[model samples]
Target: MDGKRVLLVEDDSAQSSMLQLELKRRGFRVNAEKTVAAAAARIEKEIFDAVVTDLRLGSGDGLQVVVAVKASQPETGVIVITGHGSIDTAVAAMKAGAFDYLTKPVEPEVLALALRKTIEHRDLVGEVRRLRAEVKERRGVSGIVSASDAMGRVLALVAKVSSTDATVLVTGESGTGKELIARAIHENSPRRDGSFVAINCGALPEGLLESELFGHVKGSFTGADRNKRGLFEEASGGTIFLDEISETTPGLQVKLLRALQEGEIRRVGDNHPVKVSARVVAATNRDLMKQVTAGKFRDDLFYRLKVFPIEIPALRTRVDDVMPLAEAFIKKARVRTGSPATHFSPAAAKALRSYAWPGNVRELEHAVERALIMAGGPTVEARDLPPEIASSAPAKRRVKAKPPRKSRR
Candidate 1:
């Protein structure tokens, strides 16, 4: 806090001078005002790091000064001093947003300590603001590139559930943009100001997945070295997105159900349960109902997850969107590789539209990227596509042999 500015408001000239000298000695820029009116005027004209004021000015109380200082600059910290200290007066000063209260004949050390604490608090506040700004910049939505009805419907569901705290189950084939929709929901919800914690249920084994979601106490397992907070705890008051929920084992499903119902979770090897307020949004490609019938998933758990279900349509069903999706992917790939301008020829577009994309949007993206690298000119022709895609035409036209002729003979 060296070279920080401070405003001192005191009617006593000698005390004000001594405080100013001490603050200046500590490398602070000190400004001394003899009355509440002068302090208020000075504050209106300039911002200060901290303000120190006596309760009784020559003609007015410093409570008014506190109010004015806070009104003018809400970020500034205020400290109140009183010679005739009383419980009521101190309470009132604090209620008016005073950072600290000091009794008369205050020790310089105590005063210095309060000032140091206030400065540190201000620094923490600034850091939080900076972090929030960075998140906003990174996740800010301008224009998402989807024009297909499938993507449009997904976006609509996101908007609807973004305003509610209901658990959302997003179901789609792999690479159909499940994570993108999850982020959109988080950004539009009231929890947008908080963190969005995501975990893939299939990414880790059962034991690790449990610890990852619920955290664990020190030495909870063989490798546990310290107490670790789980994704649910870290996402408290925010959203936890569980991707590929179908991959979770039956045992873990029971534990997750309990946590969802009770709004609390127990860390592995820990007896104590920690309460959480995180909203859950789970996604999967497999049919939980089918899995439940096969005894791979719990029936009750499936119902709980489907409370606000949103099914994402496969890309093949949205034929009109193929051209747009391909164009977008080509642009993205080109920008990433610093390649020259590129476009698909009419024949190439026709082949893309006619073929069934078994791998969905992800496969189309890879095709476009590969074609961009293979095509020499600006236009990507049918020959530029992978052999699988180019051979789609022959497969579509195959005729059945004349089995009937043999029967007639």
Candidate 2:
């Protein structure tokens, strides 16, 4: 604060003189005002790093200074000083946008420290806003990286549903980017700053999954030593993405349904229920409705989770995006693997487009990574692709384009 300017407003002449002298000695430029009107007018015409004012100004209020400072320069910090027993009035000043409050008999050291903290905090908040804006510009719509009409429609739905509090169910074949879609919705939603907890339901047994979702009390079961907060609690204001949701048992489905309906979860071995507000976004590779019909899944839970269903198209179906996605993957994979390849050869493009990619987008990403590692030149050739994709190149692209007849016209 070597050259930082401060505005001091106090009706008491001697107190104002002492405070201004001490602030100047501590390396601040101080401007003294005898009333609230003078301070507010100065704030309107100029900018200061901070303002120090008495809670009770003669025939005027210190809150007027705070209002003036905030209206003109919202980033400026305000500090209010009050008598020893006027904490209530000081708190009211704080509610009016004062940065800090000091009771009477204010020490110069304490005021200096408070000023420094307030300015530092202002700078930190500004930087955070700048960085968040930069990220939003760089990654459009959560960065799904697709350019097909089919995928475009899916992205449109994602954009629409992200603004509301809705339970989403994403369905597609394995490796068709279901989880990616779920994450896109969460990142674009209002709860983006909150926790994004994900887990694969099929990866855990029924008892373990129960404890993991709702938590368990200490000594609830064998090896239970301490109380644990579960994923639902961790995702209190954000999203919880459950993958392979079809794999959950029927009993677990009943509990999940209750949680959805009641906005609460009962921890294992605990009678009390804890409130939770996490948005659920579940993904599955199977026909959930079919499972419900066959009695393998709970019908009530199925309907609850499918409030906003999104079905991702398989990779082979959006053939128009194949080459574009391959190129994008190459940009990332080449940096990771230190590959010399820069682009795909015509033969390589044909192989990528013709093959029925059963494994979908995930498989395409891995294929590009593998090709980049195996390629020897600047171009990725058909032979560099996986055996299944390399041998399935279509016959049409194999033939050269017919050149225009010489002078036929």
Candidate 3:
């Protein structure tokens, strides 16, 4: 483990110093305080990785100290030291979020072991909590579902990074769930209730793209009818997803870099600047670094967008997830179209698994829907699939030559 910030609250000077020295010796940055009040002030001012406290400080109960530390920073671990070791107090401390309780005259080895285990357990629990939060947020939205390990990792990263206002770059091929990950981050973040604006950078022309991202005044162009709010302003206190970011022109890249660095955007035909407060998540199917090397994309903009990068894996890479994703899509389609229960045949599922999904999960979804329509029965069969997928079944298996030919030879 790396050096952790530890707040030690103890009334005994010599014992506190000794414990501080031992913790410092074992890769901990110690902050020794004699009173719970002082410890509370320190915790309010700065974050501590863990807190160690004697059960009875000068005039306060260490249980209060544990409660205070946990309240202020729920992520921080608390270890309570008690001299009158009783089962009741220990149970209370643990219930109150104390990572572990140590009795007075505690052995150095025993304390160290408890501290190590508590820290590890706290880290693991934090990770799980973060992941669950991401999943909850992602599921609350409509038309999105995922259970792949790659998506799980992406959610974990999104949870950790969503608390801060950081620029995130989501890289993946088209239909690989980039925008879904971005939505999850936004929904779990402080801006959960705010608007989420998305625009395709590759779909618009240079001038229109600029005007769309940073709104223009009335009569700014031929079709400009009135002063309109751009996506940046519309997404204030929320998130703006820039899809196909690699398609941005050089001039647009410069403008985007300025907006990210300065948090201000100027509308076309308007001299005044508009201050924008929005988290940015840019997604691109192309290799941005390659684009930068080729002088098509700016290096500065690339670096700015990639501050918190997440890569979404294609369906081909996570083939094991096909069946689960298919079932989820079936449920979704059943609800959406008000159709009766629909499912996949074993042959259809086998076909799905064997085929290399060039279009990723999105392709699998469309194929399943198509099969549902074409099937003679309720279940989707291999024959119900399109030629591309159906033709791959026989080719997926290896054919053994006849042994008679070898014998004749």
Candidate 4:
């Protein structure tokens, strides 16, 4: 907040001098102007963190100054001051892009507080803009929808680690886009030109899982009639995403550990080992460390997969991402179903933001799709949402239930 440049536009010389002295004392660089034309010129020629102007100027109205400052630097905060303060004037000032309204003979402390708040708002707007730009840069490639600062940091980490061949372990609740992150890493890596094979370890039996991952020779098992390539082999020179890695049996864990340590795998029926250049990216919703301690998961395998761990935050933790994600999903739904729904109503958006999404991003995507289908108009209203979401009470509901009265004799 200190040393922030301010453009002061006031026609009253005495008032301008007093305000400038106070602001300078408070560590602001003040540039005083007496007319709207001078302030407009300063705004165009120089940059400022905030503009403090009187509603009434000598030559022209301060609204002109506000408009000029906003046109030049929309991020700059504008505070309007006036001797004849009224509701209409305040509303007009705000409509003209004033950040705040202050009456004449304002207290120094009040003015300072307003300035601080305005600066904070400007900073937040700037940060959101930066994050949006970053998200836009990797929009379709990352396939991630987020506005929260936490997810921004996660994306930053993804960018840093995607260039390397280091093994990555993504830990998050089910449906939190763990596989998407893995794909993002692969897409941005040197192996992006090659195949990106993914399989859910928990979705297959132990015996079949081994054959699916390590491959099997012809007639290796009862169902094996022909030679088959495993994910590791299919993904050779690329990346292999092993989702639900924690679900692998203990015996399979040893084989996985061997693959990670030695960069080799043995087919089920073959005696010779095959070298694989695939970069392994694993994910799990369970606590692998706890499984290691309980003897359910091999300790060595756990350590190998945990080399470069990335934990995704749950949807409840990144509530700021909810609306953007919902909007993105709505757009996707429109394309998939050829729906006419273009947006969510205010009530529907409120319901979305208020709900605690236990199923994370996957759940939100599905919900938006459902709402789009159920919507009658171009916008998705609260009634178009899922039953649980539509029926849930508002966040500000404070009416408590009355206690049940005993039946009178």
For residues 134-226, write the lDDT of model 2, one tens digit per residue. Answer: 776544464577799999999999999999989999999999888888888888899988878999999999999999999999999998898
Native-vs-model 4 lDDT?
Answer: 0.88
Best by TM-score: 2
lDDT of 4 by residue, 1-409 (tens): 7899988999999888998999889988899999988888889999998989898887588889889988999999899997776768778889999999999788767887888889999999889989967764553354788699988988887888899999999999988889899989888888877888999999999999999999999988898998888999999999999999989998999999989999999999988899998999999999999998999999988888888999999988998999999988988889999889999888888888888888989998999999998988799999998989876536443674773464321
lDDT of 1 at 273: 85
Q: In model 4, where do residues sit more than 4 Å from their true spots? A: 1-142, 393-409
> Cα miss at 66, model 3 (Å)?
41
TM-scores of the candidates are 0.64, 0.68, 0.62, 0.63
Clashes of each: 0, 0, 0, 0
lDDT of each: 0.85, 0.90, 0.83, 0.88
Query: Which order, best to worst by lDDT?
Result: 2, 4, 1, 3
Shift of residue 3 alpha carbon in model 2, Å: 4.4
Extract clashing residue pairs from model 2. Answer: none
Give a tens-digit lDDT track for model 3, residues 101-217: 889887766766777777787789999989977766545443355567776787778879888899999998888888888887787788977888999999999999999899999
Candidate 1 on 58-177: residue-level lDDT in tens?
Answer: 879989988998899987888899878776777898999998999998776777778878777877899999997876655644334567777777777888899999899998888776
Where does model 3 exceed 4 Å of error? 1-144, 338-341, 394-409
Q: Which structure among the candidates has the greatest lDDT?
A: 2
Which residue pairs come into collision in candidate 1?
none
